[model samples]
Target: MSRARRTLSATVTLALACTTLTGCFDESSPHDAVRDFLVGWQSEDYDLAAGRTDGERAAVRKALANAKLELDAASFRFKIKSVSIDGDESRADFSAEVDLGENNPLWVFDSVLPLHLVDGRWKVRWSPSVLHPQLKEGQRFAVDTKPTRRQPVVDRNGASLQRPQFLYVAGVIPSQLGDKDEEVVRRLSAITGFAQDRLLSRIRSSPPSKFVELATFGRTRYLAMKPKLDTISEITTQRQEQLFAPDAPMEIVGKVSALTPETEQKLGGPQRAGDSVGQSGLQQAYQDYLTGSTRTRVITLDLRTGKESALLQEWPGRENLSVKTTIDRAIQAAAESAVDQAEVSALVAVDRSNGEIRAVAAKGLDEEDDGLAGKYPAGTTFSIVASDALIKAGVKPTQRLACPAERTVGGARFAEAGQVGGPSPTFQENFAKGCVTALASLARRVDAAALAKSAKAFGIGQSWQLPLQSFSGSLPKLDSDADKAKAISGQTVQVSPLSMALVAAAVASGTWRPPVLVTEPSSPDPTAEIVPEPPPQPVALDPKVRTALTAMMRAGAVGTPAQTGSGRVYGVAAPAGDEGSRQAWFVGWQGDVAIAVLARNHDPAAVAGDFFATLHDPS
Candidate 1:
């Protein structure tokens, strides 16, 4: 052959070889098709995935719709593990890591997808099982969560804090009310004492198909007005348990109710509608311990039979545990009775020997835990720290001091109710008389750091790691002479009743012991041993200072009209002229108990004496 014929033949052969190789590489394999389909499905591209399936595209779309509804707000991620193919058939194995919620365990499962040849290309075989095995047509994935029973709160004496009580829940179904929604709400408000406008607004904002709660009432109160409530249309009532506390010192033990939107977000999980959760106080603080664990299971629901079958993953909930607190019933009752006469009053008593909080009582207060965390100007009650600082600074109790009518510090004047004209009174006598001028005059004598250090020795202005929230009081930095005077005289310092009581306890015991509320576990676990927290480092005081302080307080308690024979009560009232409101504070120690009483619009000495008198004679 000639050179030109050979060149043409070689070029045509090379072109055919390149075309054949391109066709072999471009043709879709069963394994590649299955992998691509899985990628689309995992990415939630249901439209793309359904198109990659066989003639059952409608079925695939339906299954995807059901899955979207079941998953709801949950987030999930998928991974294609391996794809195996043999001729016209293929199998794609995959796994999904689903996030149910914070309270629920993460759900991880593996599934397989079956693919077959359709015409000339491979396509996935659509079925509910492709999402999860054991799921059939019309069946969907659902999570069934069963929460454990709520445990009870008990006192130190093992008495149940909660009592069984009946309550009526009133609500309205907006759809059933139709056009009479406003009228029905007005009638319900009239019968139940709920706000008419608020109830109407709630009904309007709620979905027409949902029931909006109006109010809750005691069973007896609801029953007496049942006839009047019945006259309103679309009104509904449901009876349920409402926990009550007849013997509790305060209303901080807490209550439970159906989860609200706010609570649900704060405490995330697979919580269904109507799940009860703690709403306040100790119940809210120890919700996880009180409510225990929740049983979560992924189930395949049969739409036709209304039955459910578990899909391999199941978790059993643990039992709830009770919470035990250190509270003496007798002391709590006495404390409650002591402040019953005042509109706003609080009292705290601690065992001087062990620092165990025995009682905490308050009335007409809005804050939690008997207002132990409430802040107020220390007033003359803070004189305890002033006395300590003075004694530590070598000021003798017998040292004669002038009790002036008024003294000025840091551009603020300090005065007392009854100031002596002469200057013959001793330091002990001046403190007993609640002489703010005398204490203010000596503010420049002691170092500011030394005074603050002395105050912290009594557990004031110290950070504590406690199971429950509390305020130990705070002492601001005294940078000026006037600030020091105000702090020493209790005019600028703030304190809680608990901190004041602890001051008295420390004075009585000569050492500060951190207070403890929980002595033993409410729910004992045989397998788990309870570990006791180490005691706080002791803050020791000079025995001479404690003795002198005790003697001074006793002397101050003398001649008071409300003084009782059981114990001496030393206290002072905040000057009414300086501040708009008057607060009386009394702190004393008797036998092994140290007590502090704070009353608004009442005499602290009188209230303290009355409380001691009641303790002496329970008849």
Candidate 2:
């Protein structure tokens, strides 16, 4: 869009028969002077062009330089179209193309270069017409940008995710402050925790009758501080509602703030003082598509009047293009509500059929999007992958394994199996009971390499297609028996809640596909259309391993806290590592949706049960 090309038909080459000592057409020939004038003008060497012209040198230079700045040109090229001679005068026609970037199509046209004879030498008799056919003596080129309507980010169903939320806005009308303005501002700052000088400055610069907002607070917080705020005579308060994104912890919905010097560069063109722009999450990632392009008009301004005089060309921007996402708003709210009691928690749900994400809910101290990226030892959850590794090595799911309060394997001690399962618990029985000892012992049935390979097959540590800070599961090198034991017990192994969700998805769908959050965006430049992302690569699970793992988890859930999930759910609860207090976790799937939950200071099994039960009712 910022480049230009010379039209081949407009190119004119004159091979004059006459030659001077300069080895070109003779200087006296009108064609020679026209050729020299064209070269100098095209190169923007106004001095040389004026030398071959009868125009004022400074005026010619200023006009040529002004055109480049007015167009904000990236590149401008000129080509000689034709030349003719009549007596001592001549006429030279040329094509000019100026590239105005970010605006579709180049500014291209043809204008005449008037020539005359001065003594025996041919010279161009330049005038305002030489620059443009319609340009007047005191006219200049100007560009007008009209921004198109910004589009909202919507879910797959095109449902608006934004809802109205009210806040308390505290301010004062500058005219009412008068001599007490500084005193009033100081008192307001003390109550509101805002800078006194900053508040005073805002009030002074604002219109005398206008309300100068100094601070804002949530409803509850404002109510608590209202008593103190009332002490200031000039203080005022107003409740106003603004559109806010859905109240979910994942931040996938994003937030917006006004344009600032720091953020102005984020937009493509000159920014206004208060332009809205995305600051984080999907909103920031897809800002260009959401904001769209601006309509551009190339016009002329009467230099003397400093006002628009004529229209040259106009191009409209693509508008009303929505940025689509895979988030299910209802599901997200439900997920967040289910884990509301935890001090810190993360829960992610995915569609079992495809990798499209359904929800990414986290709360409290899980600021790092723990659901998407907080890496923690997965506890007994890694058993899914470890089980697959052993199963491939020919270990039976029903093989009886000892579940004791404490056990040791490969020189590493393991505990935390609170109680034994039944009279004779099998490997599956121990697994459901959150048996760290029994599972760690199984590390002997297969080599360490099988664990890594099985982990890969489950999409753990694979490439995640999301444009976010996320972690795929990672297994430590099993260089020693102690490493294998810890890895097998799910301690010393770190994985995110998202990693567990995909693992559950693999079990449910039998093929693990990378997760997707956003779709392709429409671009302003037609030829600059963005390349569509490659479809997620699917890692097919082994039929034997999948069948064994599914059965093992369903039967195993019978002896653990997660055993409460309405009998219809198939998942497993695992104990995460903590020195003083342990976190809770449930990683598995039910029906067509796979889920993973990790909660601090709460029961993982109970959280999972509550989540599924709520999904069933959703009331």
Candidate 3:
């Protein structure tokens, strides 16, 4: 369901119904630690709230003394009535009243303030710091709160794609901020649309040391409301201040929080923020690389005067680390742009010499599509498995084979879409022509088990380990006579275009090497890093069988100009009538470079036309 369609009214209703009968217990304190936290905050004493953890107390005291340099000057008083403690976690109920000496008072409740235990004492958590000049008002700011950390994201090229620097959330303080608190509540309500009592309650009960609550875009609606910041008395802006490497794919990768509702709920929502999660693309895949460390900074504030008691501060946080990858930015962009026009297609390219991946993409699948890993039936292109089976069964490429109209098996008839179905043609001719019936007839002579084995050896149904996101296309096992028959005809199993390309790549390389998307190490340990190995030193296929298949692929690309011009076109093969001829493929090799192009939603002729166009103009 779309996020906009969700109604937060239900959640608000539940919270209100429970709190109404309790007489605002939301303003009550549940423990001494909670009380201490509030008292320290009210006094702007972070050290006391922090339980004087080593020097955090001293740092906070120092920051408090230099209030003009550290906090906003205007004071906003908060009244707290109660608190709830769950293990090391806690929440304080409060209402706030802001006074700037002008305008009406600003009041709010219903604001949930998060608190945590530090060195055995409860303290305010995830707070937003006010900006300068406003902070110029020494001894005016009353509330105390700390800042939250934002996660960073990077591209495959180790470029700094996304990072958190600093932002400003602002508004003018209202006077009568205490008497006209209700009217002020209504204005804040207009900006936030939160319930009046809730807004009022938040302002009334906030810790005296707290200034402002740190806010983020919670949902699509919140993001949409961003444009109207000018209309609202309070306005905020997020800005970036750094640059990094160019991106590999079309989209950004480090969206780690991209989780489902069930998962998010299990993780305690924003209360116990799990590290930023891979929400989509490479970010979702190599989340570890993009994930860095979080830091904490502590300052000192006065205990009774509610001012900065010191002038220095220290914080505890982690340093950043860099990661390197093996994607070609230019190639990734080219592939992404080419496939963007398709409804449902995927493209993956790997370096042949080393197993480093250059690019990976999906056409038609939206950025959030995870179903790509599942199965989809492969059409006639599956015949490659049958052809390999035929050659293994002693059939020669030059040997004549008959192309028939139909072949019945298990009471089902399979038809061929060849040019001349009445007569016979050479094995090479049949393959070039995609004489499905003939290939099936020849495949019948081979053991079904052996054919399935060959398919497996060719990486069919094998899980591809791309560094970013990927689909582990599959092929179910042949368990029965019906399944075995369907397998030979490419009907019983489903496969992804990525898997098909790997199959072509394996044949071109003379052996199987699982396709990879991450970078390959120099003189790397063959057993440590989890990646596909290079094709074996010697070819897996017998010399004779390999020769026959090579000749057939070459013949398949003959007499077609579109299939002939890309990369010298030394080796070519066209598989026609696959998926209602909606997908036309050209697989070939030019010395060390091997490429495969699969086209969707086009006639064989049109598919072939576009296939060569991309090959010749892969710029």
lDDT (Cα atoms) of all candidates against the true structure: 0.68, 0.69, 0.47
lDDT of 2 by residue, 1-619 (tens): 1022221212221122112213644555776666666655555566776777777878777766656556655445666677788887788787877655543466788888888898778888877677777777777766665555345667768875556656676778865776898788778767766556445644543335556556766567778988998888687887766544444533776775544334543343323322346677766666666666666777777756556778877777655366677778777766877777676777888887887778887777453367788888888888887888888888886788877777777678877636657656788777776688788787777888888888888777886656667888788889877788788778888888888888888888888888876664532223455764564478888898889888877775555554443546778877677323468788887777788889887877666666776776687
Against the hidden reference, what TM-scores do the models get? 0.75, 0.72, 0.58
lDDT of 1 at 277: 68
Clashes of each: 0, 1, 70
Ranking by lDDT: 2, 1, 3
**Model 1: residue 216 alpha-carbon error in angstroms:** 11
Expressed as tens digits, the lDDT of each residue in 163-244 for candidate 3 is 4323223222322153665665676556555445434433433333343332223345345656565555433344323222
What does the lDDT come to for candidate 3?
0.47
- Candidate 2 local lDDT, residue 557: 54
Given candidate 1, what's the lDDT at residue 43? Answer: 50
